[model samples]
Target: MTTPPQPPERYTQLKAVGLLIGGISSFQIGATLAKGLFPLFGPSGMVGLRVCLAALILLTIWRPLPGQLNKKTLMLLLPYGLSIAVMNFCFYIALVRLPLGIVVALEFTGPLTLALTGSRRVLDLCWASFVILGLYLLLRPESAAHGNLHSLDPVGIAAALLSGCGWIVYILTGTRIGRTLPAGLATTLGMSTAGIILLPCLIPTLPLIATHPWQGGAALSVAVLSSAVPYILDMMAMRRLKPRDLGILLSMEPMLGAISGLLFLGENLSSARWVGVLCIVTASAGNVLTSPRNTHH
Candidate 1:
């Protein structure tokens, strides 16, 4: 006979869920802080500080030697780090022109698509349709609140979509390392790789942050909330969650981002935008609720 989950295993799964929630919350908080820094450092400069300082902080903790990783492992890990660096650069740039919530909503498309791509269940398709419709309403040219859809910066929209693609790579590679190493230590190495990729971009921001202590302080905050807290927690959760379920769990991102934008950044969304958020919430939540027991990692 198959054994049922012991209390310990059940507790562990619950902890994983909590970590996922915490990670997502911290990530949005970090994004909000990063948004506020844009004026002082500009997008590229602020991203540079966030990525580089975060690398330094993580490295301080783990102090990984280069020789520890074989050539094959380095090959896999490098892409993950590079994706994170480029994604942050592109995302902050998109933030320059877009509302935080909208950017996050748009970025979800990549993962949502990935999650629903091969599902054979009718219920799954229903949620998939909701995602499609929600995105359409978000992008529709006419708005009930304003009588016209808010104009979007084409470049910003493109960058946000690109950010979604970056996240896919991040998830794939992060899952591999999460399975093989201590989450915290693996993150340090990953952040070091990201730091290397972002170093050239940081050159111009050094003087700006040095002169403006507030900007430097903000960078530190980003490192903690964005990279340290969320990345570590996510790695922990990934160790116990399926990638599809994890993708679905991340669907909460749009709602978290929208609320964060409204409260922290004074950004408002149209009715259609709100609907889009709701659809994603439903689809993602339903994905988790209705998923098979086997889907749970």
Candidate 2:
């Protein structure tokens, strides 16, 4: 039997919930902002700028000492960093040609698949079915309101799927790193490694920034909102929220991305896409709510 949480504990939990929502909102807003900059910087440049600057901001704030890094740390950070690089690179590439909400829903399949993996429960199959229906509705040409199936770019969809695969790698390696290093330290180092890998991509953006200095400020804002601030807030939230609660809250992201795209980027979705988004959101929430506790696959 468990005792009820006291008032102070309840307040802290509420605060953590707020932080998690804030992080999600920030990330969506940042993505919308990055989409706006695509005409100026291109997807590769924007990815490079966002991740590199985000890594710099995180490094400055966490300041992981040299001694904190070792062979084992490097081993963990390498894959984590590669995943980050691949995830962001592919995500931005897809974003360039796809609606923000659609991209988010598609990319979310990675974590959704991760959660539902190895579950033999009959109820879990319902969630999996929801995912499949949602994907079909979202990607089918007939579902397009404009009556043009080609409106959805095949390459963009493929990139989003690839990005999802990277996310799987990121989650697995990140979980392992969390056990060995402090959260902030591991995040900083992993981001630093990603920055190094993306350096060549960032190099080409320097000339463009030199011409338009305001672009630098915009990139920094993207970095803070998308990565640095979210990482910090998520770490803070994880300390107080249960994993189930955190996951349920996170399931709201696709909806939030849709809302953000509509409000900030003026990207409207068709009825089919909206239904697909809701289906994925429902499946994600159901998976978190119904999955067995204390069991890892």
Candidate 3:
């Protein structure tokens, strides 16, 4: 009888996991840097600067040829760029007003919702229930014993919700366009488009650098850490892992963000908020564990 075929290499699985963790960690650190810079540039200025600098860095690296892509590709990329722009803008707005942990937890809902939307699995319903519990804990009004809810700004909450919507759009667009283009090229062009769209906003703020060099420096740091570094790492990671594995790895971002915010920004959450975090984390982890190993896409 013919010998059986050998099993796949274990090293590949290990390497993929490592890449995913590295990507998520890079993103968390980037968010922490952005939060630190918020006081200087405000949300809009910081996001604009981040996109512009990221576009420059990625363009240098990818050097995607102009006019090479067809109209079909451009049509797909338009919403992708818009989603990225809006996601960054709203996330910064929330970051400026809320604790980092809270903002991240809120944003986690976006991808979680996307994952559960079309699934008919019973386990998916379980995940949905936990997510609902987490949201309730995060958004519920504080009781007298818990003190005031004044720290939770309504406008900031709204902005965070909008950010979640943008993230959903990003996920959908990624599913469509990511397959057709290389990750590096797609990311570079998408960010470049966003930067160009925001150019008008930057014109007014560019003069502030002369009078406020410190603010300019802060903005530069945010651009480097939040946009360029994370984007590059994410592109690298995407090459190693399947989409489901990547999603599972990204679930760790909120926890990493919470830790970074605690260490660097002195941001803290209440006991209830911690519970909410646990709920969301459990839901994500459970989904990943239950998913099949053969499910590549």
| Per-residue C-alpha lDDT of model 1 across residues 82-200, encoded as one tens digit per residue | 88886888899888888888888888776667667789999999989998887776666654454654677888889988998888888788788767666676678777888888888
Q: Which digits, one per residue and each the tens of the lDDT, describe model 2 over residues 190-266?
A: 89899999999899999999998997789889999999888889989999998888989999999998899999999
TM-score of each: 0.86, 0.95, 0.88
- Whose lDDT is greatest here? 2
Alpha-carbon local distance difference test for all models: 0.82, 0.92, 0.78
Which pairs of residues clash in candidate 3, taking residues 3 or more apart in a chain or in different chains?
A: none
Query: What 10-residue stretch in candidate 1 is worst by lDDT?
Result: 141-150
Candidate 1 vs candidate 3, lDDT winner: 1
| CA lDDT, candidate 1, residue 76 | 73
TM-score of 1: 0.86
Tens-digit lDDT track of model 3 for 1-297: 975444344566666677667656666677777776666666787788778877888888899886768888899889999998888888889989887887888887887787778778898899989999988887776663556543477788888888988999988997788788887888888898888887765666688777888877767766777777767666666766776777677777777777777887888777887788778887887777676642756
Candidates arranged by lDDT, highest first:
2, 1, 3
Q: Give the lowest summed-lDDT range of ten residues in model 2.
A: 142-151
